[model samples]
Target chain A: SQQGEEDPQALSIQEGENATMNCSYKTSINNLQWYRQNSGRGLVHLILIRSNEREKHSGRLRVTLDTSKKSSSLLITASRAADTASYFCATRGIKAAGNKLTFGGGTRVLVKP
Target chain B: TAGITQAPTSQILAAGRSMTLRCTQDMRHNAMYWYRQDLGLGLRLIHYSNTAGTTGKGEVPDGYSVSRANTDDFPLTLASAVPSQTSVYFCASSDEAGGNYGYTFGSGTRLTVV
Candidate 1:
């Protein structure tokens, strides 16, 4: 089942611009992760933010989690044309039977050079 | 490291034909999963195996089957292909079950049913 849903089905931006995407989930989660997929290929793990943590960062990627709101945001700074891809937010809820992850509908981002 | 690898990167099959998508990981992860991604929709789970010899159905498992006879391999089989079954299939594996570690996904298999 789908637990998280991303906002802004698609976005287009110029290279070097910052890109931000939001995800909202239905239930409490142990942690939230963001993944990047290129051209329908396998996903690459970007960053993960635990429920207890409010924010986390990796290089140019920044992730924030708000348990009270059951939402999260991913920010990619200095976006490049190569960064154009689909971003998905996956939630790992405490109640998940076996640590299964529920992925949200991804946000398609296009970085035009 | 090889990480996760999926066989038959792309395939075209006639309706009613049966095929299996192969996934393997060198990570020795205990949890493996099969998910299908359709246009405009998020990836939906088809099946998962928490460990070798244990399997469970995910959200969509009607025409699909999975087996985890060993830790390194998890294959998804389509008993009978249907037009609606065409999508990009991804295989993922995690070191542990919960959210402790991130998942490693395979390149993906693009299957088209005609």
Candidate 2:
């Protein structure tokens, strides 16, 4: 089983609505990162929240990490149709190096324009 | 700049045949990885190399072999391809270890096996 598991395997919302996705992991991790993938391309890194950081924001994306609960949330405000993509949460084990990442099942988001 | 280039954007291979997926990066990264993506499974690492001349198995390494003879290239080979091996393959590279510095992924190679 993968270390990270994302909830709400699929989500549908309006273009202007906010979309929130959650990710939970089983082991201690050095950091958690989120990536986005289109229909037929490679994943693009979205955000990275370190274990020591509680919250971070970039552009319209806000990410929060709670080490105590081994969970994290990504919030996309004012979502757009272009944001329609699969979101995956990946974790780097506390003891692991070499840029290795373990990915979750992913959350597929559909934004109706 | 071509951060990473993957050959043969797509290919069809018959079962019991051989195939090799090529991955090259221009970033001079110390780490490279190969992952397979399937529906509902996200992406699973097949193999990885920390540096030249080293390789390690990942989550689903079965039926897949990889070699990192140099820093610029990492090739994944299937001795005898199987139907289950059909998936979108992605190659990624990073300057250091762990997720502190995220990875830059290639466009991906879609392979099908009959």
Candidate 3:
């Protein structure tokens, strides 16, 4: 089951630009996580924000979670070609244990040189 | 460090046949999961285990079963394959249940059922 939905199914940006993606979920969650995947590759964990955390940062990435709104956003600063990949949002529910996450369709981002 | 490994990077199976996809995690994580990825549909969970010797169904559990005999191994089985089951399968693991911690995923197995 898909618990989250991401907007801007696809995105194209030039190098040095910032990229932002938004995700909305249907249920109350324990936490929300972001992942990146290159073509034909496994997903790499990017960052996570607990329900109690309104904002968090890792390197050039920033994540904001709004439990009241059941939404989250990921921001990438100074995006480069290396940042070109599909970004996914996953939600872990309150009742679910062991990281049984429900993933969104993902946003495809292409950074042009 | 071989965080996670999946066997048979890809496979071709016939309808009504049976096959099992193997997964192993060296991280000694207590939780393991199986998910199928399809174009435009994203990744859907099929089964998961909170610890060794336990297993539970996920969203798309039909036509799939799983076993977790130890912390290092989790395998997904298809009793009877079907065309609709063709997709890229991923195996993931986390340090604990309730998944506040992020997961580490395998490269995935590309399965084709005809």
Candidate 4:
């Protein structure tokens, strides 16, 4: 089942701009993860933030998780054409739950060069 | 190591034909999973295995079957292909069951049933 739901199904941004997307989940989680998928390709892990943490960063990507709200957001700074792809948010449930990762619909970002 | 490899990158099959999508992970990860991606449905889990010789059903396991005979392989089979099953399938693996680590995904298999 889909544990998370991403808002703004699609977004358009120009090169050197920033793109941000939000994801909200319905249940308690162990962590939240972000993935990127190019057209016709598999998803690649971008970042992961544990439930106890509020924010983390990797290169140009920043992820913030709010356990209280069961929501998370991914921000890409100074985006480029190469960043044009579908970004997905996934949640890993508590240990008692299966090790499965539930994914959201994903936000398709178009970076115009 | 090849994190994960899915066979028949893409396929077109008849509605009643049976097909098996293969997945192999050379990373020797202890956890593996299968997911299907539709246009707007995102990715739905079909099956998962925490370790060799153990398997579990995921959200959309109705017409799908999975087997993890060893640490490196997990295959998904469709008893009878249907138009509704026409979607891109992805195989992923993580270091452990709790998913404290990030997952590595295979390129994916695009299956089309008519």
Best by lDDT: 3
- Quality class of the docking in candidate 4, CAPRI style: medium
Off by over 4 Å in 3: none
Compose the digit string of candidate 3's lDDT tens values, residues A57-87: 9999999999999999999999999999999
**Candidate 2: tens digits of C-alpha lDDT, residues B1-114:** 869999879999999999999999999998999999988787899999988898999989999999999999999999999999989999999887544888889999999999
lDDT, candidate 4, at A39 = 95
How would you encode candidate 2's per-residue C-alpha lDDT over A1-113 as one tens digit per residue? 68889998999999999999999999999999999999898899999999999999999999999999999999999999999999999999887757799999999999999
lDDT of 2 at A51: 92
Off by over 4 Å in 2: none
Range of the 10 consecutive residues with the lowest summed lDDT in candidate 2 chain A: A91-100
The candidate 3 chain A region of ten consecutive residues with least summed lDDT is: A92-101
Show the colliding residue pairs in model 2: A98-B97, A99-B97, A99-B98
Given candidate 1, what's the lDDT at residue B27?
88
Evaluated on the second chain alone, the candidates' TM-scores are 0.97, 0.97, 0.97, 0.97
True contacts kept of each: 0.66, 0.79, 0.86, 0.74
TM-score of chain A of each: 0.97, 0.98, 0.97, 0.96
> Can you give the lDDT of residue B17 in candidate 1?
94
Alpha-carbon shift of residue A110 in model 3 (angstroms): 0.4
Instruction: Kindly list the per-residue Cα lDDT of model 1 for residues A30-54, writing each as its tens digit.
Output: 8899999998578998988999999
Question: How much lDDT does each candidate structure score?
Answer: 0.92, 0.92, 0.94, 0.93
Ten contiguous residues minimizing lDDT sum, candidate 4 chain B: B94-103
**Predictions ranked by DockQ, top down?**
3, 4, 2, 1
Query: Which 10 successive residues of model 2 chain B have the least lDDT summed?
Result: B94-103
Model 4 pairs whose backbones collide: none
